[model samples]
Target: MEIEPYVDTTLDEPLVPEPPEPGSILSESVIDELNMTVWTLSNGVTVWLKPTDFKEDEIALQATSPGGWSNSSLEDHQSAVIAAGLVQQGGVGAFSTIDLQKALAGKAVQVSPSIDQNTEGMSGSASPEDLETMLQLVWLYFTSPRQDETAFQAFMAQGRAVLENLGSNPMAAFADTFSVTMAQGHPRSRPLSVAILDEIDLETGVDFYRERFADASDFTFVFVGAIDLDIMRPLAEQYLGSLPRIERVDSHVDLDIDPPDAHIQKTVRAGVEPQSQTIMAFSGPFDYTAQNRVGMRVMAQALEIRLRERMREDLGGTYGVGVTGGYEQIPEESYTVTVAFGSDPLRSEELRGVVFEELRKLQVEGPSQEDVDKVVEGERRARETNVRLNPYWAAQLIGAKASGQDPRFLLDTTTIDAVTIESIQEDARRYLNEDRVVIVTLLPAEMIGRP
Candidate 1:
């Protein structure tokens, strides 16, 4: 499949669209305690503006809306993944990929579209002076997404080459196996393979992109950092307000992907290296709430500290350990806590036993005051730093609104401070059930002798 050759279409003068009248599209702006302004645009696109001197000449912009992979069927999942990458490679409107690069030359502006489990949107940063250019690019993406067969084939060829030997790599195989195990045979959880890539149609992927981004009304645009409302309003009206609006109210559809109910243990023998990787996952249906989410995070941190001490220092078994906990909002609201480590294949079982012991200890004795204090202080410092940044606010506001929570929740720190040892212990007791755990181990073929 040969791609269309790039042709130079440079002209003596570049065409630029005229800005719309700012006064025509009125907005209702509400100033919050954190000095952020929430503006509801006439076209139903909500805009969150936080003017700051954090950076002298830069601003961050994020536009997000729900209905991502949730909008895709089992057969179309691979297309959804390829379409996001194709959008950037295919360029925007009439500009070829190289031509688009030439058009953006010498400008510190970047914008890219992406899709996840529950949302799809674009995010980018630009200099204050180049805000119009940023909005223009965004407008082009939503209005005229180019479908270049050449770019699509090229991207697929590159992806195929990379994935050709992916299964031969032990870590990659483990990751694939782990995903399937956690998802319990859900169609969306299937690992990417050459067979799956072969099924992707360039035209179908492009059409999927168009269908997902068809309605711009549901999107909320968040802009933060060195911004003046007077300068931003016109650009917002011209590019965002002028977007094609449809009477469509779209949200993600739950596909009902859930973890296995009973405990599972799987061991994979691969690669030639003399090492083993182990993952212990505990998950269950959880009520999605602000306080519960905070408690899970705090519990993960406390557990991480204890794991590092026992696994790395005391036993000298592994170089390091990783622990993470989070709740997913789609399918059904559920939380997972995972602890993973790499160690000698011969001692894999022993090290895993120690990890379980620590969990049992946390359940029985609970974390100490010192452990709670360390996590709280670390969280406080992180919150203080993130509050001053634009990307942080952009992500926070988008997530809050999508989950039907108040944007003001970003400003509330009561939950973080309220996390006590008792609360974390209670959460641990409820979530970390031995009967519901999933343990997966990957060992070298030589160490475990393939059956």
Candidate 2:
């Protein structure tokens, strides 16, 4: 469908609501160690305040909840994706996207909502003077999200254009194949296709987004940067506290999206270049503790060092390689470690063998003290830098609260010190099971004897 060009002149002026008055604060406390304050608002919404002088005039805002695609049904997947995309595209409250832009022309503020596999949240930054404007925008998103059909159609048109020739891209095809295989063919795991784009309903999409963001009581708002609690408390009470509250206590349900339990290998022949991409993935359930999470990171860093030495430096099979470890609290607390790289098709299998060899070595002999020290030092430096940034604190606070963890865990730097080489080796043995691995190799058509 061809969408009519949106003309700003014909649209009516947007109805901007007045800023809410400061509401009553029920309770407040400070964590002396972290230098942060936690406030329980009269409306039951928790607000975290961390005053920092890192950016003299900037403040970061994050509003998070535990419900996301996990709160959506399989049938609503397409709608949910479209809804989240179009929600901000169409604008909030009575403002059209164009008008909203005009309204905030001089303000240094940004706010957008997102729905992930297991979480939904909004993140943006604003100048200290524009904090009330930021709160007002947040209130609008929660209370009144305008659905413009024209914006939805335009978004879908752009999306379809991007997906029209996606199959022609060999790397894209390989990524889709890898996702499908790893997700065990779960419907939600399927990559977006042109057909799925046509299946999305605008009304359904809007409703799905609204349902997930309906209740404000379950939401936790975190604000960080150069701001005073005395001044912020009243603004938070008026704008955030005045949001409509509902009694819904929805949380993400585990959809049982697990990787295959047995060893599985898949090879795809595509593209014309004489290159092959390989992903060596190992995944399983894990205890979602701070200590365990740190242990997994240590293992990934150590494994990357070994792979670089064997695969890139010694054998010269690939230019570079990467090892990534991820832990998810929802869907039953699990961890996945993926080793990915690209190389000549002829040497791909040889490099793949080396990947396993490194894992086996870690399982038996464990990472060297030198390797462990390198990872620990790198982590320490990163943590030290992150603690001084407002964006980092915002993310950490929201994540910790959503996952039912102590916010002090973010301030605790001792976990890295406690991650011993033995713990990393144990993690390797427990998580790197050969039977539970999924290997995907994408080779050139010529290499696989295909036209």
How many clashing residue pairs appear in each of the predictions shown? 0, 4
lDDT of 2 by residue, 117-173 (tens): 777888999998888888888888877888898988788888899998787888888
TM-score of each: 0.94, 0.94
The sequence of per-residue lDDT tens digits that candidate 1 reaches over residues 3-67 is: 99997676322324444434235566666675777766677777888888888778998888888
Off by over 4 Å in 1: 1-24, 448-451
- lDDT, candidate 1, residue 140? 79
- Report residue 191 deviation for candidate 1 (angstroms): 1.3
TM-score of 1: 0.94
**Which ranges in model 2 have alpha carbons more than 4 Å from their true place?**
1-15, 20-22, 448-451
Instruction: Give the whole-model CA lDDT for all candidates, comma-separated.
Output: 0.83, 0.85
